[model samples]
Target: MALIDFSFYSSIYSYNHLFLTVLSFLVSALIFLASMRKSKLKRVNLPPGPAGWPIVGNLFQFARSGKPFFKYVEDLRPIYGPIFTLKMGTRTMVILSDAKLVHEALIERGSIFSTRPRENPTRNIFSCNKFTVNAAVYGPVWRSLRRNLVQNMLSSSRIKEFQHVRDKAMDTLINRLKAEAKANDGVVWVLKNARFAVFCILLAMCFGIDMDDETNEKMDQVMKLVLITLDPRIDDYLPILSPFFSKQRKRALEVRKEQIDFMVPFFEKRRKMLQNPESDKTAISFSYLDTLFDLKVEGRKSGPSNEELVSLCSEFINGGTDTTATGIEWGVAQLITNPHVQAKLYDEIKQTVGDRAVAEKDIDRMPYLRAVVKELLRKHPPTYFSLTHAVSEPTTLAGYDIPTDVNVEIYLQAIGEDPKLWRNPEKFNPERFISGGEDADITGVKGVKMMPFGVGRRICPGLGMGTVHIQLMLARMVQEFEWSAYPPNSKIDLTEKLEFTVVMKNSLKAMVKPRA
Candidate 1:
């Protein structure tokens, strides 16, 4: 009787256990199906792009393309039809090559496309936790910083105030080039001189003092090292592989420390000077550093911290220097390559300002020179894609569903070279601005014929200063000297290398004779 009773209970227990197990499986299946359906619903109408592999997405193809990322994107435009998407690891990057779409998305719906990517280890450290105006996500901090910079340092009134700085720097540059022309048999590599002059100009504006060659060289090293740290790595795409790049990241941190060490002393010195007014010292007329010292951000007990100040000052100097120097490089390269253009430009400069140094005030009368600079920018933008933009929220762009936080790369280089827009687009023709019936507004307002400085709300704050520097430097070079390809019969190689800025693969070596 006992055995029979035990068997009956065991059978009942087995039946109950089986029923619960089946019920659990069914519930789990239902949940998974619901989730998949929800995911499908969420991923509606994403832009058409190269079909990607799971997990890796199109990253392998992108790497295998044997081209710069921007060029690769441009190549895809013909097939993908202007606007297309690429998945890099888990991240979605949308490329906007169509001017209409770029205008529609970045200008019309700017509020959505304005913010930066979420803070990551790489960018956070690079920006001192997004204290910089350029990398900072669009928000109160960014606005405050930008307003302070624009009003104090970069505004038209402010830029005009800093005219003396640019003039002095230009004079020094011309003098140095003259020396080089004499020493190098009328052949000079103008890059060093160009870089030095722009650095000095930006340094004075940034730090309220002129740095000596040694100091300037040291700062240049620091900037180059810092820029080297910014090169994209595999870990940037594959976060799971980040540990392998720990050494690289560590080196970047060390470089940042060195940069801060070099920059922070200026901030402290300025602070001390402000505090002690009676000290025997020449007061700086005005400087971005001085303005930053006085900046008052809401909810902050003090102005920007020294680290933040260092970051901003670094950005001010480095951003303007390399980009402007590159412009001069490319402009000079084109002048060397297209001697007819050079002759026309020299004639214009000579007519505009006879035997006088080209000054900021003189830039306006030289329209041909202005057109040359615009053409240089169109042909060889220092930055292929303007600093990357990220989506603030999920939205449709050009009738495609763009999800929140995806990367958006606007192809400025491609836009400039689009055959549909410009006649003989590949040719370095400055006269296009003069007679081509299309506008040459670099500011991207009258439509983006060329956006070397980018467009919309996030347009480079340094655009005004950069344009002035490039024009003055180029004009002065033309006015004061005759430049030609070094070692006659050699072509000025326009081969490009993607550096911190797109630079001449070979440094511009040219023969320059000082004009009587």
Candidate 2:
């Protein structure tokens, strides 16, 4: 009986061990099968891209080279061809290097291209709130708000009416610039001061006050925060750490609060003031706050929620501020680098203005002057690439089946520099915009070639206003001073680095010899 019991126990243990081993193998086999199926399913007919290692995609590409890593993609355009594909971690992006393809994707198929919203790190304070015009989804609300903004704030007639406000602001800028030149002996903090002054003017016009010290500092901090957050990274493409790391998220919320602290009170004050029948209409001409409040005051328009109101107000100041200053700086950088371009520009301004302030109307007449500005924009668009337009739905492009929820990033930088479109692509030639000639008509946002304010339905609504501001300001600044590169290099370096916007790797520093 003892011998039988021992054999029975040994047999039972052996069976159990064998059963366990079988179960484990089966589980492993199932996992492998499942993973392989997913790999095949996800591998739709997409364009080929550079081979990336498992887990990390082009982070190594960025580390090996440039700040705007898009430059690397620009480099690859010749080899892989223009419409190459990229896989940054899990994120798949299609780059449109050719101008015709860009227009096909963005302009011709506007509805398809318009769905991609601006992504994380750059979504700013207005991201969550959908009521604000820019953040709203592609729908009725967006159409309504965009129309209102154009008609009320950005129309040519409305812009013409606000000529004085723009003029007064420019005058303030010139006076302050002159003071800085005298005080610093021409080594002024031009970048910071130009940024601040432009911010102050735009903020005041929008909200009736220059942002407070606390608020201004907060805005400055947000600018720095955005630069770090907007870094082109594989992790950002995949969003694996999005939940764990909320550094960018926290910064966005904090920035919004600071903006609200300054904007809300001003919005409220304007609303109350406009309610009065005897309010000063003269001071209210084309002002931002007035338009928002006008709707409520007249009871003809439905006003946005107080939060929405403040968000809109904040974006107005934020969008307009950096853009105007950046445009000026970019033009200066271009002019300094291309002395021949500068001389022609100076001569055009000299003949048009004759020591008078360059008026808005003067800009319309000066075609060569217009060409210089156009070329500068083509060369260095402030925002080289805005957030890749998200493919909210499945779409077809170039016969490729673009999956839903993918991003289609049309590279404005590449498109502008495409050899097929612009000859001698590296050369800075303003005369390329001359009409009735070889590949001309680089005239306006509506033109086929270049788009600084972006393109298609998502084009910047404030483009017209922004264009006028840039032209008038550039005309005046060049007309007012004979600018020369300080420390006298043969020419300006014209190198670029992409921050939140593409800025000169070297700050646009120059000797401001007065044009007597």
Best by TM-score: 1
> 1-516 in candidate 1: lDDT tens per residue?
000000000011112334334433443454544435544554568789998544456665664554556666767888989888887655777887877777777677778888777534875786889888888888888889888887778888888987877788878888898888788788888788898988888887787765678988888898888766776655565575677678988888888888888888877776777678545255456678988876887557788878888788878877887778888899998998898998999998888778777777777888898889888888977766766787777788878888777888777767888888889899999998898775666766767667777777777877877878888888888888888887887888888776667778889889887777
Q: How accurate is candidate 2 locally (lDDT)?
A: 0.62
**Which runs of model 1 end up more than 4 angstroms from their true locations?**
1-41, 277-283
The candidate that wins on lDDT is 1
Candidate 2 per-residue lDDT over residues 1-516, each given as its tens digit:
000000000011112333333433443354544445555555576666776534334444543443345666667777777566775545667766677766777778778677644455535345434555556667776776677777777778877876776787778777877887788667554466567656656655675543465776666665445434434332244455467447656766766665566557766666665666357443453367776653432222566666677667756766677766776787877777777888898898888778788888888889888787777777776665644565556777777767765667666667677677778777778887786253433322344576677667777777777777777777777787767777666577677654445667787777676677
Report per-prediction Cα RMSD to one decimal. Answer: 14.6, 14.2
The whole-model lDDT of each prediction reads 0.75, 0.62
What TM-score fits each model? 0.89, 0.82
Model 2, runs deviating above 4 Å: 1-37, 40-42, 54-67, 117-125, 208-235, 246-248, 277-283, 293-303, 435-447
lDDT of 2 at 281: 43
